[model samples]
Target chain A: MKVKQISVFLENKSGRLATVTRVLGDNGINIRALSIADTADFGILRLIVNDPDKAWQILKNNEFTVSETEIIAVQVPDKPGGLASILETLEKSKINIEYMYAFVGKSGENAVVVFRVEEIDRAITFLQENGIRLLTGKEVYTF
Target chain B: MWNREMETIPRPQLEKIQAERLRKTVERVYNNVPFYRRKLDAANIKPEDIQTVKDLERLPFTTKQDLRDNYPFGLFAVPREEVVRVHASSGTTGKMTVVGYTRNDIGTWSEVMARTLGCGNVTEKDIIQVAYGYGLFTGGLGAHYGAERVGAMVVPISGGNTKRQLQVMVDFNVTALACTPSYALYFTETAAEEGIDIRSLPLRVGFFGAEPWSHNMRKEIEEKMNIKAIDIYGLSEIIGPGVSSECLEQDGLHVWEDHFMVEIIDPNTGQVVPYGEKGELVFTCISKEALPLIRYRTRDISILYPDVCRCGRTHKRMNRVMGRTDDMLIIRGVNVFPSQIESVLLEIGETEPHYQLIVDREGNLDDLEIWVEVSEKIFSDEIKKMEELENKIKKEILSILGISARIKLVEPKTIARSEGKAKRVIDRRDVYTK
Candidate 1:
């Protein structure tokens, strides 16, 4: 139920984000989802790629500061209350959400929401016990 | 003038005094300082061979490294008991370039400073505010004693505390301000930010030194502060910030010929250059008691104006220092060397020695930013890890350079590599200073 996410440190200079994308694209690594945490001086480009290990090796070889982190992807109903219902359940269980981003599934009627939480195992257990469908690493990587 | 008899002494009389004092200083150092004696002996020159100031060329030139080799008190001529004071500057290596002062040396420093303040028209009635840092740096006490020597009421404010500096400048009716040129401009900006019009203050004269500044900067300070800014020159290896100063003429700094024997030498060849020609400014301290430097190479680039000044002072004047022959950067009046930064980076063993220093001036203040290449291990992609490394590097730089910097962790191989001498410092302040 855990997916691997890679984050790259970037100085807040023009063309840096473009460079990161080009590096990943040149290596045939497709980014499935991404987010950026930024400040006036610098930014962190977090990416979920189809091949995280290969992407990590390529970026590291290119002298990019890259690290791997474990994140969870939960499939929620494509309806309006999908994300809100899962958030309400997690909030009830007192599992804090550090950060989250979502993408619509390619063929399924459900949407995949990636989440970073305080406790990985506890969050996975709570979501599974609550009848929430969790996407595995391979499923999320291809989807 | 503070001392009319000496300040305006005729050229013939000045040379006679310089020659006489030069002989005595060489003898004192050759007898008292083992380092000087060994250097002279290695060069096959005896103290008796140096009969006049012109004979100083025969002596070995002392470098800042020599001072560090004799760390703490190795180069001091007088015994520890007679040494009354000590001042030091951070060396490129871990050691410090230290200088000691006897009671009489301190008195001589005060006397030269008195003449410095006098050049700024600071008299007994003037309320002088000394903002140069005190302590181990020669700037603070050097200016302080000079103000006291002339019977001026001194506001020993040292440095920093911008709000208090402005308040006291107004409340005490400060007439003369003594500090580094950068600090003076920084004060102006801070005062403007505080909505305090510093130009309207009672300040009339400014003595700026301890760093190389340009004529344009002088004009800016004078215009902004509504005061006359005089340039004062000195180094810790020499006697702090009172080695020389500008008179009302503002043409060049008048080296106290009675105390110091000035020489302009070609930095590349170590040969003496003609008067009025640009070269490295060198000095031989004739009056210092504890530390008698012999033909000490200052590494500061400038020319000596032996011609008479319009102010009628016959002491030889040196043109404002244009730049340095070495890779020393003066940021906020503190000397920073790239080697110093490289050593710190190497010692930390976190980042590669590949780094670039970007120095620019913002708001009339010098801003330094160092770009260090992040190795794969240190750049864990975690913001917290990178931030901790950045903080560690910043702290080390601050502790060593005595000036804060903005540290940017760059991707490896981002900094350009030069084919020859690696380009380390990219100083952008020269345009503004010029």
Candidate 2:
């Protein structure tokens, strides 16, 4: 139930984000879901890609500081209280979410939310016991 | 005219006094300090052989590494009881170059500092404000004692507290100021912001040292504060800020040859350079009682002129220090080395070993910004984690170096990889120009 995410360290300068996307696109690596965490001086570009290992290698070879992280993609109902209910479940179990971002899936009835939690295995087990669907690495990469 | 007899002693008479003092210091160190004893024995030289100041070259040169090897209290000629004070400055590593002073040694320091203030003709009627930081660094108490010895009312206001400094300067009618040249410039700006015209004040002279500054900076400070700026020079390894000072003429700083014997030598060849030529400065503390150094290499580059100054002081005058032979950087009167910063990063084990130190002057104070390349091993998807890494590096550097530096995390290949000696320091302060 773990998905590999590619995170690139981006300096707060013009065209850096564009350069990262261009590098991945030219190498045929499709970015499925992405979010940027920014500050006044720098930003972190977190990405879920079709081929994470390939994207990581390409970014590293291109002189960008990149790393691989493990996150979970959960299929939540496409409704207002969908994320709130999952968050409430995790909060009851005391599993801390470091960061989270959402993306609309091809199936209009559901949405995929990427969560980076502190206790990955415990979070996966607790969420599964609560009858929530967790997308595997292969399923998320292919989708 | 503090100690006018020694300051104006004839060249021949000064040389005789130096020879006599040199002989005594060599004998004292050889007998008391085991480190110097081993050094002298390894060189196959005896105390009796060093008859005059010219024989100083026969002795082995003492480097900062030697000081570190001895650690604390290893180089003092006097016993622990006789040593009354100790002052230390940061070394290139975690260890510090420690120095001790005896009662007589403190008296000697006061005498030289008095001469330093006397260069500006500071008298008892003048109220001197000693702005140099007063702890182990020696600038504070060194100037304080000298001003008191001159019978001047001393305001022992240590460094920092800018507004308080200005208030004391005005309320006390300070006539002389002693501090770093950069701080003097900073005071001018602060005075203007507070709408206090410093030119209209009674502040007349400033003794600036503990860092290398340019002639242009002197002109700027003099113009801004309407004060005669004099350059003073010294190190904790020697007797703090009293080794030499520029007279009112402002031509060159006069080295007190009667107390400290000065020499200029080719840094690579170790051969004595001709007079008026630039070389590494080396001093042998001839009159010091506690921490007597024999041919201690200062690593500062400058020239020595035997010509007597027009100020009637026969002591040999040396030009302002041009640069250092090593990569040590002085930021706001504190010693900083690139290797020290490297050691700090290595200990943290968070960032890559590749880094660069950028020293720049912002509004009359030195600012150090460190550019460290982020490594993939420590990079995180969470921005807070990355910020924590930067803060950890900054805190470690501050704890080790005693100065706060802005840690800038850049991309992996942002710092250029060099095949030769890596360029580690980028000094944009422009304070070292002649």
Compare the candidates by TM-score and give the number of the best one.
2
Model 1: per-residue lDDT, tens digit, B335-415?
Answer: 889988888887777555778899988988889999887665565544565677789889988888788999988766678
**lDDT of candidate 2 over B337-403, digit per residue (tens):** 9988888878767544878999999999999999987787767889988889889989988877788
At residue B47, candidate 1 shows an lDDT of 81
Model 2 vs. true fold: TM: 0.98
- Candidate 1 lDDT over residue span A9-111, tens digit each: 8888999999999999999999988988765667778898999999999999888878888999998889989899999988988987778889886786978
Give the lDDT of residue B237 in candidate 2: 92
TM-score of each: 0.86, 0.98
Best-matching candidate per lDDT: 2
Task: Supply every candidate's count of residue pairs whose N, Cα or C atoms clash at under 3 angstroms.
Answer: 0, 0
- Cand 1, B chain, TM: 0.97
TM-score of the first chain alone, every candidate: 0.96, 0.97
Runs off by more than 4 Å, candidate 1: A1-6, A33-35, A60-63, A67-143, B190-202, B413-417, B420-422, B431-433
Complex DockQ per candidate: 0.37, 0.83
